[model samples]
Target: MQRMGGASASLVLFLLSFSAPAAPIPAGFVSWDVTFPGNSGSFDITNQTGPNASTFPDTTFPITTTLHLSGLGLTVHFANGSTVVEPSSYFTLSADGESFNGSPIAIGGTNPLPTSATLTGTFSPVFITLNNGTTQTILSSFSATISPSAGTTLADGDFAIINATTTTVTGTPEPGTWFLTVAGFGTLLGWRKKGLATFRNLLERKGAL
Candidate 1:
């Protein structure tokens, strides 16, 4: 009985180790280097410091092919000289998996982010490779300032201080992951207990325990 109790305790300790909190996501660029379906070459935006329109370097595509902007890193400043750096982890790839991941932040004076043809998210026009193998922006009737700061009025104001590169944000697993892990550990403990019981029974029959 005592041996079985010790075995059970050991199993509990092992499981507890895996349940410990994961480390926080590191601050800075997380890479997202991938090619889209229609691209002729690998669309490299490897180290974008999210601002303006980042485009693929070296690789040339047909003029009609539109290779718009990629990456998202924003810096918001306040009149008081305070700054907020948007973490890269806050974004995931767009649903189509081809556009920049867009997220909005609330700013001064009852500022709610606008959704219409406005400037709060995208900093520049989408770039298209021209038929001559040169790039041009399809200027939208509406574009907003990426540089937003505090004291900027809620109306006609830019809140994003700087548009910068985007990266992946690593985070901890959910409770469901822990639950599955514990279940696996329970199976291991059960097998160990069964093995111990069988050993004990054999020893008793041999008059050894």
Candidate 2:
């Protein structure tokens, strides 16, 4: 019994050592950078300071179609009066297997984040490409490096946001169908109970449980 207890205590200690702290809320966009294979095209992102649309300008990102983005790499820069941050990666988007990515803040806000700290998302849109080796496209998820831009001077009412998905499909279910179905179910139960009660009463007159 002594050996077993000692072994159990040792195992518990080992588990505690390997456990990690909870991840923090992806807070401000102090800085970041994302790089990706060339050929990624222009992608747009939304930026607003508060809940309104006038805080920052809506902008489209630059692209590098070469195998590698060289010295002129993309970046997002952020700074409060006393602090600054930037991204080293790009945010990405895709459809039917094709992709596009960006390395700057997708959306910007003015007040939610301090100039010293801002949130940023970089992306790389993924798509299949053929360079004479084959004649087809197989959309696959590809990494798009993203981060903050170089020389960013964030303002008090400036921020960034990423619209996670752009795909919109619309269809309506049989409108009122579910509500009617639920009502039908209650009707069914009520009728079933009434029939059972009637049968029970008749049985009691004759003889049944």
Candidate 3:
């Protein structure tokens, strides 16, 4: 009877170890590098739309969506020895995945450039296709330039983006969640071993072993 009670307790403990719900994965940021062909300038872009992964738009075709930009940053390096930093701006993805119309992004509101400027233009054949529900391409062409404010000719020249590679963000489990998962498995294994030992001893004492 004592062995049976111990076995039952161990079983309960093992079950309880896995009772905690799994933690939700946290959202990540999307980023990409922009470079121009036969030019000495480049730029980088990073954007996060929401606090979680659920805010990402579905990449399915026949859909025209405007992704709201939150925490958007753009850094432009001009060939004329000038660099400009920009803030949050929005863009539109055409239904056919062929056009990328970027909204005017305000640049040079900070140091190094000091004067304000506007960056604007359109990219064509930005063809985006999905494979197994994953985005294959983001921006295929880039046609944009900076329109500097008065007395600021630092970043004033037509720029053509020759190459761009995008990286989509994926969610990951939190550190605490990983710890809990490991601890639970450890407790379950310990309880299982203890239960088996008790069962074996009980059988031995009862002349069944």
Candidate 4:
């Protein structure tokens, strides 16, 4: 009877700390690079923690994502020491994207991984919507451990979105933003070459490339 009780308690704990793929990002942070015709920059997504923020089951070293929402929140930074905190209606969403490459596995090919592995990507639905009505985006260092239980589809990679914030980043970006933009673009193109995919939504629109 004691063993059964302990088992029940474990299961209950799992249920209480539940987290789902693309469920909704907890109110936290997000950072992304912004690029124009030839110029590029980056900005951070900041917000207030909600009432249940403390209870949100956050996976240690988890991956982050953005949704590129259509309205009510938008911001941008540029290379010429300028920032664009457009009105809420100025935000736009684009469904054009694909998955990134899964982390490199050993060449020898173990049928199943004996231990956990860490992986991250910029194009997967790693972000979640917070109950506080604000979006939670992640920083560049987001990550996760890969185990058999995660799923095969996820074996490919993750997703990302473009977000504009209420605040503005006024500055000439450091070389980091340019480098990150290059990396982001390269990854997106590689996913295309891999025949990953791009979704289309008339509502979100796709003006920026």
Q: Which ranking of candidates, highest lDDT first? A: 1, 3, 4, 2
Candidate with the larger TM-score of 2 and 3: 3
How much lDDT does candidate 2 score?
Answer: 0.30
What tens-digit string does per-residue lDDT give for candidate 4 at 1-209? 45445445554443333321233333333333222212322222322232223433453212233332212333333233344444533322222322111112221222232222332223223234433233333332333332333433222222232221212222233465545445555554554454433433432367543
Off by over 4 Å in 4: 1-14, 17-70, 91-159, 162-209
Off by over 4 Å in 2: 1-172
When summed lDDT is taken over every stretch of 10 residues in candidate 3, the lowest stretch is 24-33
lDDT of each: 0.37, 0.30, 0.37, 0.32
lDDT of 2 at 37: 19
How many clashes would you count in candidate 3? 0
* TM-score of model number 1: 0.25
lDDT of 2 by residue, 83-116 (tens): 2333333434323122224443422344122222
Estimated TM-score for each candidate: 0.25, 0.18, 0.24, 0.21
Write candidate 3's Cα lDDT for 1-209 as tens digits.
Answer: 56456555655554444342322111112222123322322232222112212322542221122223233344555435675565444445434333323443333333243232333332222332222232222333232333343455344342222222333312233465456556556666776788789889999999998
Q: After superposition, how far is residue 209 of candidate 3 from its true place, in Å?
A: 1.2
Q: By the lDDT metric, which is better: model 1 or model 4?
A: 1
lDDT of 3: 0.37
Clash count in backbone of candidate 2? 75
**Candidate topping TM-score:** 1
